[model samples]
Target: MVQHFNFFYDESEHSRKINHSTIVSENYYDNFITTIVGWQTADEKIVLKKYLDFEEKYSDRKSDGELKSTTLKKRQFKNGFASLNRDNIEFILDLFSIFDDNVLLYFSITSKIEYIINQLFLNYKNNIWEDMDMMRYSIVKAIVMYQPEEIISGMYENTGELVQLLKTFFNKRINVNKTNPKLKEHETLAFTQILILLDDINVKFDINWNYDIAFHGFKKYLIEKDISKYSLFLDREGDDGNTLKAAKQVGLTFVTEVDSKEITGIRMADMLVGIISKLLKSLHEELRYDSIEDGLNKKILGEGWFNLNEQQLFLYKQLTHIICEVNNAWYKSFCGIYSDDFIILVSLLNYISSFDTVNEIKAVDKKMHGEHFNAYVCKELESYFGRMESKLPIDPIPGGKKDYFYNQRGAKVFFNSSKQPLLKINEGCNIFNVLSVGFSNDGNAMITISENKNFLCYRLPKELFEWAMTCVAFANRGDNVFPSKVQFTKNGDRYYADVL
Candidate 1:
């Protein structure tokens, strides 16, 4: 019988404070990390023994004999790992080298607060923007559904207080502007209440989101390598086991829980978890974060975010390389073979890369170096357009506009709402309805129609083109379906699409 590959999984978290909070206040971002370690069952004994030897050499906990990531800090070397700073680094590097030799590693990180805020504000829920029907239930579900069990149970225990707070938060009008003091205070308190109510929702979202991504990555590896069966081991503590159900939902067949003390693979995961947590913090600190936090007024990552010392840079390169390499490998296996949905992602990423100059690059480099290295990692790690920032500049490609109205400047044009972006290509096709919806990428959302050919483009902002990709029809041979009629309309910040 062929021996199956066994996988071990673990998670880590880092909470970074973005704003000053007193004892009474609470506002910060919780970044979540999940790492998966996998190896063949035949190597289990060797892997476990290697873990034990490494623990014996570095760990100070004799009774527990399990290496905890929290104790692996550089400053805690005296009482924890019992090695010099450089030695501790080398120890982890050596351990990761072992992992590289024997096991496949993958991780998913999410900044919890960022996701929460985006779901709350930029999404249609705030109602400051468009009143699209799809957004109606989304706000309620995003808030109510993802509550942590503890928060839900606690609310049940104090139903009266919870009800009153909910009533207060809902009844108050949320003013977008801050010129009026009373309205501003009301909005401020309302937001604070919402945050308090959803205190644990962030963690729950983080767990689900990160778990789903990590499992997907692992599954992709299995499929690409043609491995049919594998056993999964998750640390039996906390929410680590919470994702087992999710794994099953995603077609994972075998999973079991193992205590960190009993399994060396999980111990290795524990170390990587901690190391990654630290690296996240160091990476954030290395950047000119003020511009990232405030605005892009100053040069982004110009002061050398990726310009790192040798050791620090090596670790950064190694970890990011592992993620991108693993993901890109999976992407390559199917994207070129089957023309996957990720073809859009490739197009978008290529579009972003086109913006690179002599000094800046948008995507994370495979080696985690080169121009704008810091910007690349930051974009990879953060939400697509979270509260911290807006969409990057996407300048229009000028040659596409052959008609006169498509070249119109500074005019408001609206179209009937449609489902997907309208794409048409032909020689000398320059006759149709022309409406300038809005300016994006310094170009209007213009519509052009010709005899039996309708090309509708530029409805939403360029950032939204990503969401419209799946709906886009690529004009190719064999079978062609083009929208006969399309409409694009913008109501405040919301853009709508309809097709007929």
Candidate 2:
């Protein structure tokens, strides 16, 4: 049997990068990283077991009740991961050890500044200013670098007002001022040209620019991965209306949003992204953290942070030593650093490649390292995700077949909302994630019928839902109260679910 893939995606944002550029007065840019950790579905159980075991054994027993990388103090690693206290350092190594040879990684780093500048100029590609993409970028770069601070503080709310602001600012700059200390002489003309060009266009501002481009980048990576069948579970607070449509374009067989708290894979992704982002930062600059705190921001580098035991002290180094060979399918790495100011990316990759284990960083050199460093990774990702596979399981419905399915021997149910019955049948490893009791769509509640694929809703008629859930007594119970193993089977056009 051909094995499919399961991917868990997690994303995080760090402090804005302060660029000492010759362009803007306040050159602050937001840094965002999205990590997709993938493994063969066949090995999903094994990979998940590793995370669970480590969390049980090594979690710091913090009151937050999560063994998350976010909880790890930065001051603990104020010097580097090497300085992380023993307990957390052990967590890091043991956490990653879950992958074995079955895991794959695709990470992309982008910035809001890059997203705005490139997208702003993308429209002018066929216009007279098309050839001057960089000049156009520089013109807008200096203006939006501070982002809703200087010129665009309230411009986003109303485009007409935005245009007026731009018109007022650019008219003065072009006719009266004739020069900006930030922008060069020719860029001044470029700025004036952009303002005039905006008049012909709708001039829309995309609030979801970063996420849209990030998904596009992810889509590109998955396509290059050449995997025919795959399921993606992402941990996010809300839904991206167009993301589902966009993700389907990449031939995803299954996709769903999972709570990181419950999904081991998402939790692992959270840790992976957290560590890698800081790892990159550590590689780029010397640590100058504030004095350690009560794990707040000071006294931050305490014994509990990274003061690891002698045996586990090598774990941090173990991370740096992991082989990043280009041919290694076990871990395919991609870096989508926006190119214009890719020096930081290059310097980090330069250091990564210095170790024979980091061939992954070099993969971006040609794409992100051209002279002006202006080729954005979004384009590279967009180009890579060009082809689609023919004749495959397009979107496999969970448990669509007629068969008797049994939940795990001991399963737990959890609730997300207090107002209504929105049940999550977390069979330990997230087997049956559906079962809504209060839903009254067409005189029925919703119950997901599936084992390990996209959720397929099986609307239980009010009669059956009431009868079955009463046997289960799901309504009155609190979170994680259900501990019975239930069996579900489809008979003809009707479905039968029994609480066994």
Candidate 3:
């Protein structure tokens, strides 16, 4: 025999209680009859009736303390089921199938039903003069059971039926020009919520939802109130601009103006880079794992393949060296900039390089002792610096080999030139903390190369004097030396300096 179960509120506050004795067993057909009968007796229906009665009685009078207390009492009576065990309640509800006639009654006895009831009571309680809460609870209850497939089927079954039903209900209860201002507002918000839920259900069920109808209804709902006025733009056409504009107009103070287009581009770039980096890391891991597995599973390479194996290892090391070189090139390109965004980007790139480098080195170190791996890394570094030097016009002067002197103001300056009357170069004047050399690409620019901040170029003949003065001022400003890159444009008409 199928066991019957029922969960109802036990109002006794002393302990967790359920009125298990109320359980009733009936045939499937009789169960439906019993459920409808029980719903009539339920506190939700009773409270709803009382709320409608109160609206009728107090239609002329202003809301008073006694009326408010009465409303609160009705609410308490409706919400009395809050003490029921939720899990056991769900178990009892599962007895009714989706197509069962008792399904509506099952939902009526659940938590969501209780919530709707309390809300309706509260709505009418506050505004006794309003006609009604518009029987929204009934509509929502119907929607909850409507299910996505049913709605789709219903839409096809009668084209105008759904819209007619909605129109009739909305027209009867919702007053656009109601004297009770709160009632007008609540109804509008409730309508919007219902529309959103309908959209959600359609999307979840993969139905061919009508965006025009949904948004149009939402727009109409918003026009009824000033606070929800910005919701009008939610249906507006265009890019993300409409949504952003609406957010701003609604006094959504926390939404920031970070240049949506630029932010989106940056985010996409970051995602792409991150994906590539992960792929590279995965490849490296696979190579190392295969090498270890091969060594364990098979015999060591014969003398014929010894040279091939050595060459393969050599090629792998060279590939890593190339990766490092490319990273260095990227670093050099942006090193002259003072922009915080560029700096952050460079930092992240360097971190990715360092992470990969550390892992590769560790893996190689495991295969060979510290000496072979360390020597290989050093050779790669040497090659990198050699390539850098070949590209630069000025050679690096070694420490102690170069002459250092203090000016009349007692500021130290390092000179490679063995000439008298040393020119005073301020810290900011040295682009990327490197001495300014003749401009590259043309005479329209000057370049300063340094490892810490990289290159600084000052563009044009016009801004040279001002750049010089600014550098001198920075020198006189005491201990905090500014490192920057100054670049001159090709026309010599403008000068650009990376000074932050």
The candidate that wins on lDDT is 2
Report model 2's TM-score to 2 decimal places.
0.50
Q: On TM-score, who's better, 2 or 3?
A: 2
**Local error of candidate 2 at 226, Å?**
2.2
Stretches of candidate 3 off by over 4 Å are 1-311, 314-321, 324-367, 370-500
Write model 3 residue lDDT over 1-500, tens digit each, in one string. 22221111100011111111211111000000001111112333443343345434544432441222112222221111122234422321221111122111100012122232233233232122221223334344233322223332333354334444444444433443144446346545555444433332211111221112112212222222111212111112245443335444544423333331222222212222222223222222222213211322212111221112222333323323332342222111211101212222222233223433434534542434223423444455445434432322222222233465432223333353222222223433333443543332222333234444433233334456566545543433321133344433333344455554
Question: Number of clashing residue pairs in every model?
Answer: 11, 17, 12
| Ordered list by lDDT, greatest first | 2, 1, 3
Query: How do the predictions measure up, each by TM-score?
Result: 0.46, 0.50, 0.16
How well is each residue in 280-331 modelled by candidate 2, as lDDT tens digits? 4543233122211111211112222232344343453454343243224321
**Residue 407, candidate 1: C-alpha displacement in angstroms:** 40
Model 2 has an lDDT value of: 0.49
Ranking by TM-score: 2, 1, 3
